[model samples]
Target: MPDISPLLALPGAVAGAGTTADHYGDLVAEQRMLAAGRAIVDLSDRGVITVTGPDRLTWLDSLTSQSLATLDAGQSAETLLLDPNGRLEHSIRIIDDGVTAWLLVEASQTAALAAWLDRMRFMLRVEVADVSQQWATLGQLLPVGSPPLVEPAAPNGVPLVWHDPWSAVQVGGWQYAAEDGHPAAEFPAVEILVERDRLAEVGVAARAGELPVAGALALEALRIAAWRPRFGGEVDDRTIPHELDWLRSAVHLSKGCYRGQETVAKVHNLGHPPRRLVMLHLDGSDALLPGHGAPVLHEGAAVGTITSSARHHELGPIALAVVKRSLDPAAALVVEVDGVAIAAAQQVIVPTDAGATAGVPRLPRLGAVQRPQA
Candidate 1:
């Protein structure tokens, strides 16, 4: 899992699932330190893949959901690799530095995703390499609208700072979340790429109280509060960007042909996504957090499934669930966690009528029947 033995030696550090730290003795204090920008989270479990060659940007643009053909140096964007059916396969945090495109993704996805990309590079000039072993990730809270402050630039001179674009809609993107007061409006966070060998330095500093360090759990809480859809947690084999409001940042509606662009356009224009995403405020009377894949029930019938849940420092228990689009927007739901049903109130993230095409002209359906009386 990325060999976090260096961090495990630190006081209060506890091993967490999937190469993460569960907490640092006091989770609440760790979260507070993170929110206040006094601590950073070790995200060594994340992976990095670098693509080089002259055709890198254009080749990638032609394949993924985002428009990357014109990406400039230091530009950051998120893209989705979709299957032929438009199901999400991979979600990449992209940054180009004039020479190479660095794709940051979940650690578990690194090997498979890299292998897939390598096979796709048949005649193209692009060269893909998994650089995860050499690079690690660090995350921290930042002031809203502020950039990450990294002293020494990445070896590629790219800074490798992904200032989350979730705060606002990009030029060619759309937001399905409530626009008046999106939760992500105040969720300021960033992930910075650092040398893998240097993680020990960070751990030492954190233990000495020089550089405050939090656990991945704190970051999860903040991400859930922001209604952010993570790749491994919120996505499934049937997931489309439309279902998770991912178009808000990842997809460019007018982008040219890609593998799954047809479905993207079709659903966005005339059809609604089969499922919709919601933020659930869980009843925390029992002080329990629903597990991922927990069944979300409406009137005792399964209507959705919780993708991720967390106990926020301030927000108590919160979760992101994907429910059937036909379900009532205000339906009172219950999440079954470990055989215990917990009350859940929905906060609309993807509206019931999300993906409605406003002005797009409709065309007649094929095979019109003409019945004549003889």
Candidate 2:
């Protein structure tokens, strides 16, 4: 986990007594600011992989599910790394600094992914290096055109965009990016390292100038509303990228060969994905539901399992579940937590037909009302 102690001094950071852990130190303080929307989270827990050398673009294109050739210096994309069986290995954000490319992934998977990439470098002329510590990352959702130099791409087909300090692209929404120092000759964005203690100062500066600091919980809520699946929670070696509705943002059907190309094309063109990811509105408490592997039942029969859960103050207990695709969305299901059946209503957030099937609603806008439980 990223060190968030720097956030403690920020206004409205901790609402109560804070605790420290071996991994996630000062989580209580982080959670409090996250709940109240008054702090900016240091997303340095995300690992960064730098792809340099002349053959970087071609090398990456042949290795991932997305089309790397289309990305320019100021653009970014969400792509997936798949296993031999087309199972999800990682969900990554690909940022191009004009010359070199950077891959951002969950911290825990950094070493494994780095090793895997290194092993696959058969005379590709690409150098893969871990740059996680050399740089710091922060994310915030700003209004369209709020930042002067930011490129935006809505990978999930939602209103939100991935903003960075680059020439802005007018996708569905606006995203802004800012770097600390001058970017490399090929990369256009500025790159700088802000000290941990200076994050609050940056936040204060941003707010004073009209930019608001959005915490992790709020970002998670935004992701849930957009139906974006997290890697560890909704994706794993047991499931393919299509099962998690990642095809829209991560996997490009038209991309060239990669590690899991065969299985991906086979399931996509010929077969239906067995399990599907769905959003659930829990009826009962504001507390979070059991996380990954928790059972979901219908009339005492096992139906599916909970993958991720969060306590949204406005939405009560909300969760994401990977259930049998054949199960009716309107059907009432129960998430079994500690032998207790917690009522959960399902909503198909990502339509397999990409809006051709009109059963599910589109991603909600910021501050939209929660879907009422039946």
Candidate 3:
């Protein structure tokens, strides 16, 4: 993870500490060009994992939250690993190409995830290995109507390209967002995994002005606009799929029991999620953007924390936060950035009543009996 990207040497490349360049001087123009499929983002900070053996699919399906038993070759999917109490642990972007299943994940998470998968192999025919040293990941816009700007790597006879599953709800997924509008489909991303040598060639092409390179910040802006909840930004020890409306993409409600299946089922079918995710439209008059984990204040009361924030090309300053589900959606909010409280307007992502979908009747405690569902 020691700044592996060759694009770091590009002109105007303001490389982040131990990460890729944040921008090529102008983030706005970077976003525009990247969104048009004319540029690519250096995602070298991400890591790659590969699973092989005939039992790979079922082994993964039995261990994670996705229904991967039927995942077809060349098909794209996503899955999550959770603690026993159903807290967010790791989010994986998956693509299987018959012979091997490729996993793209945060570099910080690669070692732990691979180690855990290795421990769980227990008599199974599957073998897990961290192949990050042998591969490179690059991200680009591949919206539905257009062709890819560059081809993906398929060293094993199938390209290791993972389409963003957030584009639509999966078959076993359920959506709890109160609003009908979600812009996820507009940000069609395809993760390309190439051999290390091939990426070196891309770096050469980039230096020759043949391959336009946009920084990770540009892609992050578009991701924020799409209302996508990234594991690195939104996920925490207490995060549950229900809180982020992640059920819309990552969770398979009906999948066979995984480690946290009970909590996931109980939260979705019989109880409400304790918190809901919201988007805050910040007042940019101060020209200050709140960093991640900034305190979200509702009338001077610390109600929640900002997870991710970005200045969209058109929307200006915006952020995603998780707040108490009971808080009024119309409530005016403030985000404190370095002790300066910035006024923010709230936009709903998940509603106050996002769960209990089973509609099971609840009985009153002791003498006071509640009415049953009719």
Candidate 4:
């Protein structure tokens, strides 16, 4: 039988197996590293789909949540592919390189998305191709400004140029070319991928060994802390874009018609979303926090459900909850998972106030005070 050990190693990573995923044993070692410290995750497991041709921009704009027309060269945006019923099929990062649009998404979703897009193509001139094998995906966190960043040369090459607050970038493919006196003839242009490989090169001495594999647990924790919402957790068939606060990142309201546009507009202009996403502090040991879909209770009533959970080394356990907007943030809630009661406290990370909607919070104006009549 073909060696199945490499796959086994990933789950055994928490136990400290080995340096490389050279075999099943090594993968186990990799997993341990990922859970404990910082591990450079080879996101090759993710997928890349390229959309090229004259109608690429227009075609994408008609489908996704973000405004594509305004996406200049070297910039990128996160968008969602939603079913006609408004359920999320996948969450994608759209990178515009001035030549082609590249979508980064879960590997499992790639084939389905490509097929969906192909079916929609009638008179619109566009070509969709899966380029997963041609590209290698890498991720890492590194000190900012380690190397002077260069923009993608191709017009449609770079997408979403803004820096992640954590100073990481998800990039595709690595090229080797002759250049000035650098140790490596060619290095990864993307910061995250470069950092990961650099860690591998230096090994334990450079703190590479300390980095743990960022499993789903850790990834969920980081995202929840950043107040980012995942598509599958926060979105569904009944959800409109505005309901999940997606308008802040996705959804160009001014853009012309697309599927479910009517419901999105009507809900935003005429009413408030019935449910909202919020962060919760789960009061318990790391092991007690409920997993996803666990019910949230307020007093004796069921208020909402837990969408995600994570155990921070410093903060104990925490979770993201979807609850009724009318539910008081001050109200006490509990997450009961597997017979363990995890206490929860709600926090409004994304404010629903009108003042916040206007833009940056305005500070009080200070000027010479005039004496007022008593």
Candidate 2 displacement at residue 175 in angstroms = 22
lDDT of 4 by residue, 225-327 (tens): 5455666466555665544555555666667666766655555655556677778887776467676789999887888888877665456577877787778
Least accurate stretch of 10 residues (summed lDDT) in model 1? 144-153
Alpha carbon lDDT at 314, candidate 2: 57
Model 4, global lDDT: 0.55
Question: Model 4: residues >4 Å from true position, as ranges?
Answer: 1-39, 83-87, 141-216, 350-374
lDDT of 1 by residue, 1-374 (tens): 46653666688888888676877788888888888777788788888999999999999999999999999898889999999889999999988888989899998889999999999998999999999888887888888655554342466666777777787788789887778878886677778888888887777777777777888888888888989889989998899999999998999989888998889988988789999999999999988888889899988999999999888999889999999998897788899877888999998989899876755776657887766879
**What TM value does model 1 have?**
0.94
- Candidate scoring better on lDDT of 3 and 4: 3
Compare candidates 2 and 3 on TM-score and give the better one.
3
Between 2 and 3, whose lDDT is larger?
Answer: 3
TM-score of each: 0.94, 0.72, 0.96, 0.69
Q: Write the per-residue lDDT of candidate 2 for residues 276-343, one digit (tens) a residue.
A: 88888887763446767898898889988888776654566778888887787688888878777788
Q: Per-residue lDDT for 39 in model 4? A: 50
Note the Cα lDDT for every prediction shown: 0.85, 0.60, 0.87, 0.55
RMSD of model 2 against the true structure: 12.8
Mind giving the per-residue lDDT tens digits that candidate 3 earns over 285-355?
Answer: 88899998899988889899989998999899999998999999888888988778899999888889889
RMSD in Å for all candidates: 3.1, 12.8, 2.2, 11.5
Q: How much does candidate 2 score in TM-score? A: 0.72
Best by lDDT: 3
